[model samples]
Target chain A: MAEAVDVAGLVDRARDGEPRAVARLISLVERGSTALPEVAAALAPHTGNALVVGITGAPGVGKSTSTNALVRAYRAEGKRVAVIAVDPSSPFSGGALLGDRVRMGDHATDPGVFIRSMATRGHLGGLSWATPQALRVLDAVGFDVVLVETVGVGQSEVEVVALADTTLVLLAPGMGDGIQAAKAGILEIADVFVVNKADRDGADQTARDLKYMISLGRRDRSGPSWRAPVVKTVAARAEGLDRVVAAIDEHRAWMTEHGELAGRRLRRAAAEIEAIAVERVRTRFPAADELAARVVEGELDPFTAAEKLISGSLGE
Target chain B: MAEAVDVAGLVDRARDGEPRAVARLISLVERGSTALPEVAAALAPHTGNALVVGITGAPGVGKSTSTNALVRAYRAEGKRVAVIAVDPSSPFSGGALLGDRVRMGDHATDPGVFIRSMATRGHLGGLSWATPQALRVLDAVGFDVVLVETVGVGQSEVEVVALADTTLVLLAPGMGDGIQAAKAGILEIADVFVVNKADRDGADQTARDLKYMISLGRRDRSGPSWRAPVVKTVAARAEGLDRVVAAIDEHRAWMTEHGELAGRRLRRAAAEIEAIAVERVRTRFPAADELAARVVEGELDPFTAAEKLISGSLGE
Candidate 1:
């Protein structure tokens, strides 16, 4: 058995801006450690204070560069910033990527900034189970802003939206046009769109295409809904980043005014709670292997096996 | 109330190779219909006959062309083939991709060939829950071969691997080298490797790089293990596809000899049963919304709320 963790002590240190303490807390979340309940109980009251921003886009869309730029922007405004860079494709997890840190430059030494990369390899429920817990950790640890950066592929984009109060979808010219973005379903979840690499040749056409698509999609909405604004940025050179920041701020303000922020948070909390509850139930069913063997031998169908397992475990 | 489905009649027609019956059964699986338990019970005994080959590759890697070529190759052997082309990116779902049909012209009219495109948008557990069930339906419908094709990204690739008897990972010359493939964790699950678009420049270099990486990775394995063979193919032109077919056959034979085939199927069945059980538990916990509201309001932490929910719902 693992030794008991001093959850309250860790939370206190984390709140005092001790980076290692914050890192340890997040590590517990990532591992889905047994002490998580104690940790959650200790950290709960301090959370709900930080602004959670989700940044996502396909690979080569300048997500990390834009995240670095935004971290600098947030830091300049005298706010402590934490970045949770989630690489669903990565199998290894440690601190932030060295390559990304090199691009991020001076922020490495700044005490006000913390960066961590999370890998979802071999984890059940993947990001949906771990990410929100990590966010709660950072939120409780006194970060004024937390940026969740994830690859925009498969279900990760949707999962990120479920965890964030505001989501930014990034695109680059020549990578794909507006229709392709819509096909990927990014248009549905984006609170703000960032057309990164604005210096590229087709930047204006991409932005125009996005605006047209946005207008086409908005035709059916009856009430007041936030129209996602498109902002262009050459993030590598740190050009046009101010507008991206402004758009994000505007989105936050709009959500706050319309009570959408509270609604999103409640949904996120519900999702987190449900994910945890399902996982707890999963652990109680140890007969899954035997049931599966029977299924392989053609003695039972999968659905019936599932029903039997549920009743056997839950005593229903 | 929805009318009860005549699942037994549908299964009988599906077993008789009736295309409409097969399609309807698969549709039920894709939709996660209320009739799923009845469908599973009927289909269970007839499954375990088809050879499931999972084809996955990053976008721009000629996955569709390769799948089309392989379908034709299997057809030439008088094998009835069913293709489940899963597009996680596409929100629209119906039959096959029309563009793919243009390339696979003759097969569109072939009575032995069946193709369907499934979209994972808004589905819980995404492909993991649905794809295996669809595979089961195809298996039960008397297809000699089932080719499951999906984009290689994030967790979908891993999920596909779990559902396939043999998984073929495709790569192109220009789309990152062997190191990049390894970083994506594809190297671990691939039973065979196909270097599609081999007519392009640098194909030989890409093949060599993959071989070197494979050799490096194999050094740690102690006993006899399947060394994934790298096959080259210009799939669009149907060049060098015979070797790809041979490689898949060889992998299947090797697995059967080593008893790994039964092992893999058992694991897949276990996963399916567990996912269903979790979903069942999730439905029983109607208190999740109220619990989530409390978490959002800081009246309860998520882990504690989850604990309360499990106990309340399961009477634990």
Candidate 2:
């Protein structure tokens, strides 16, 4: 499979903004193909230009509608946009959720917009391993902006924070989202917060709740700490989207000013490198099954078995 | 910390059912302390005796209440039980959910019962890494049954499945739990279906929905397959508790009869060993930050940086 992929030609086509070529490249990344090294090497020099934004919220927090609106907002500025909707809960491949896809129909025929949905069904490292590679593909292919939207369940919200240059944590009124967000540990990662469906009954209350929580936690760092702004939006009508976009841009500007953008990107790269390297080492230890059998039979402990596996494979 | 630990002495005390010794051993595991290898070595040869049961469900599904009832039922059978309540969402250490700890007050003073709450917090491998070690500590300490109850959010339900000999997927009536469970990709991992809060309306409908989903997928494997039994209970009042216990025992018996028990344990051990090996490899790559900086500066790609880090460390 690796031998069949013409990495250079595909990279060239992707650079030229051929959507098919871009899709194929992302497929390779998503599948964690053996030709990834070649693909990455080919795409390296042209990367790092796109502004990566991550939008995440719980299942009913209007993430898809918000993403659709954000895509339209970015396109109005004549910026080419790419959207990667990630479903950490769904393990199936090649199929996006039907409802979300229908809502995104506005972008189906637009040449300036690219939208793809990915599921981490059988991937061992989950989003930590695959999403960055997909981001790298979109970044290298000349998309001016890339938005990663993930279902905010479990650890995916935290993982998305690592992948984005700016993260938008979406909430809706009367859902007790403020408490849920804090309990899920996502409140600290937000560069900007969007209270979508702001026309709801308790929109002001939710916004006030978030501001109160922010104030309690905000002693401010020694340096200028970016205060996560809360913006209200009725995404279905595309209302309050300009402020959302402006808030995102302001956050990006703040990150650049603090040199925090480079620092975050560096940390993301480090994590990506560590995941790949660890996966490589794991595959080298083919005696895992036999060792595991010993462990099951109580003949060896797992830690000792792991140590033996490592030494046998790495000759350490 | 490792140098100060008397691993052998702690193991000896733990084997004698000293609660303090057992607590210390679990603390070491939870902290991923340097003494882990010593602790594992000490615990080996005395492990694999306990029946590991995993109970999981979404928030407000009565996981803690169900667990509380299960503890009472097992105690009635004169079997020693150890409950590990894992909250993957909370990152706090030395602090369990206060409400859950209060709910288990019935067993707090029972000499034969031990209950502990763990949070992933800063732990890199999450439940996959720590929960198994905690189980080993309890198993080696002579518990007849170890119940691993986790908050079923995100990827945790799947992870808990990997750790249990028999997994009970809990749901409540009137919550559209059937569809929610299916979407969360948890329906397949359940070895036993639990519809708690059976006194509520739609309990029978929920049970029917589960049975229908189960029937659609159950064509019987190549051999005799153990069909997951949906057991209903009003755990708050302890109504129908006996049936839930019976279902769990029956599932365990069926797994043993089919030799599936050994197979599950083998797979679990393999995963545990792999997590440890991967974590060790991750620690050896100290040049990651420097390489990541270069990648962030657009001088190198992450894949190539990973390759260099691997080869430089492993000399492969």
Q: Which prediction has the highest lDDT against the true structure?
A: 1
DockQ, model 1, C-alpha based: 0.38
Question: Which 10 consecutive residues of model 1 chain B have the lowest summed lDDT?
Answer: B91-100
- Kindly list the per-residue Cα lDDT of model 1 for residues A1-316, writing each as its tens digit: 5449999899999899888899899888888788888889888888899999999888999998899989888888999999988876654553446645664576867879988877766565788888899999999888999999986577887888898988999999999999998888888989999999999899999999999989888999998899999999999998888888888889999999999999999999988988887787677677778889888877788889987876665232
Model 1 scores a TM of: 0.66
| Candidate 2: residue B286 lDDT (0-100) | 73
**What class would a CAPRI assessor give candidate 1's docking?**
acceptable
Q: Which stretches of candidate 1 lie over 4 Å from their true place?
A: A1-35, A38-255, A308-316, B1-3, B57-78, B87-113, B122-125, B151-158, B169-189, B194-213, B230-244, B277-287, B308-316
lDDT of 2: 0.85
Question: Highest DockQ: which candidate?
Answer: 2
Clashing pairs in 2: A91-A121, B91-B121
Candidate 1 reference-contact recovery = 0.73
Kindly list the per-residue Cα lDDT of model 2 for residues B1-316, writing each as its tens digit.
4557889898999899899899999988988889998899878799899999999887888988888888999999999999999876565643585745685678667889999888966775888899999999999999999999987566776788899999998889986656666777767888999999988999999999988888876765566888999999999998877998899889989999999999999999999998997787677667668888878877788878877776665232
Clashing pairs for predicted structure model 1, backbone only: none
Candidates in order have lDDT scores of 0.86, 0.85
Off by over 4 Å in 2: A1-27, A53-131, A141-161, A167-223, A227-250, A281-287, A308-316, B1-6, B9-23, B55-126, B149-161, B168-223, B228-249, B282-287, B308-316
Shift of residue A38 alpha carbon in model 1, Å: 5.1
